[model samples]
Target: MPNKTLRVERVTKRYGALTAVNQLTLTIRAGEVFALLGPNGAGKTTTLEMIEGLRQPDEGRVWWGDVDLAQKPAYARQRFGVQLQNSEFFELLTVRETLELFHSLYRQRLAVPDLIVRLDLAEKQHARVGSLSGGQRQRLALACALVNDPEIVFLDEPSAGLDPQARQNLWAVIRQLQAEGRTVVLTTHYMEEAAALADRVAIVDHGTILDEGTVDELIHRHTPSAVLELSREVGRDVASALSSVQRVDIQADALLLVTDQLEKTLIELVNWANDHQRPLTGLKTRQATLEDVFLTLTGRSLRE
Candidate 1:
């Protein structure tokens, strides 16, 4: 880990009466991947903008090492590269030409040819920006962000519109950036993306940090080691009495039993169903995941 830490101190942002980001504070170790995981309109983008120097915080500071970024925004612009959620480029510019244009903006830049090859856009070098597919355009966006060879990269939903394979490819590319010792910060609504890529995750909701930690730590904190689903609803009283079950999440069409001992709990449920002469229908078992963590914390689904 790098000795210097990137810090966001007591940041707050508001628009008239609506506060987008509350007094949020967190720190990132150099060369690690950190993610602000939340649903849309949960202040993830607003928080990122303040840290990126695209927007100033209403009352807070962003610090890099010992330097206060709020007082020296230009330094951040120079050392940090950003790939916005919506990146627009000249329709007629070729992939190579676009990289060249971005490279011209920075004093120190990488070789455009090497960047194109690195981003897997070697064959698409001659293709027009207007004609590229969604995945290709996203790769090009990442390529533009790297023209200056920044120390830190901020990606805003890097794989938003990509297909499954493209998303997987993008995830691999992000891992490569970490391997190169570049710090990566991203804002995402996808739990899988955060779980798949982030070293530490901050669960955000209503413009606040509900919880923050490693995926396992967060899940373990909630004590739901496994989730069991049933086709029928077991009344709250009956479900809560199940063996080794930590909690019961009752849904309209199904009942979810959150238990610590998966095998023992399933056996107890089966015996109970058999005693009542009621079949255990539509049963499903899954290990506790970040989605469960989010729901347990907020009383709502991550996608909702």
Candidate 2:
């Protein structure tokens, strides 16, 4: 496969009064893992669908290198692998049998048993799809997607229902895909998943991109400040007096002092508390993270 960037240019999709995606544009560099991250109803799923050629954008275009996806839907179907948000398979087929069924549809594919083993379904190769656990089912869906030996893989919430260990396992598989020089695009709301897997990330909401960059870039750009939390609420005046503090936020469970100089702020707060004969209860400090960046941009929790 040629090393060409996958581009989504000014893509927009709408359903009645709701605009699911708004002039969204981004690029996926060849052989890199790209993540589209946002909360539910954030247009993440719609964006993936449009690029996978499963759903048409009401406006704009998608291009894999010089080939326009809109103009060549078969080109996408032959080269792009997609694992849908909801992948339904025949219930009674064994795992291997299902993989074989999908393999037969494509001109190029991994051997059914090899694909099953690659997905870690070796032990359950004969297990009926209906009897497989949620994680197994997810792996089967992934296996089906790979049966086409696609150049670009689109995964929508690939690890949504997976447990911690299973999620890590899947992350390893994604990393392997990257190492093998395949472009991967996955949409996820899990901050850690995106941070751990993506070479670059685009944070999207309300059908448009809010920010796009490496995880560290987004965090440092939007939330360069560290957070110092106190168990009890403190007035803005008190927090503002702290050294190098940028702002103060009153969270439901604590008072947060946002500061560029974390060590200086904590020292100042401790000295003030000592002088005033008051305890700085439950003092905790942490560097800003992707979650903070998301909240800073969207003004809401990512889980929302």
| Displacement of the residue 247 alpha carbon in candidate 2, Å | 2.8
Write the residue-wise lDDT of candidate 1 on 153-228 in tens digits.
Answer: 9999898989999999999989999998989999898989999999999998988899999988998997566899
Clashes of 1: 0
Candidate 2 residue lDDT tens string, 1-304: 5698999999999999999999999989999999999999999999999998888899999988999988899878877888999798899999888888888987877677778889999999999999999999999999999888888889999999899999999999999888878899999999999999999999999999998999999988998668888876455688777758886765566777778888888788878888888887778899888887887888776876
Give the residue spans of candidate 2 off by over 4 A.
232-243, 249-255, 275-278
Candidate number with greatest TM-score: 2
Least well predicted 10-residue stretch by lDDT in candidate 1: 230-239
Candidate 1 stretches with Cα past 4 Å from truth are 1-3, 232-244, 250-254
lDDT of 1 at 171: 94
lDDT (Cα) of model 1: 0.88
Q: Residue 92: error of model 1 in Å?
A: 2.3
What's the residue-level lDDT of 89 in candidate 1? 95
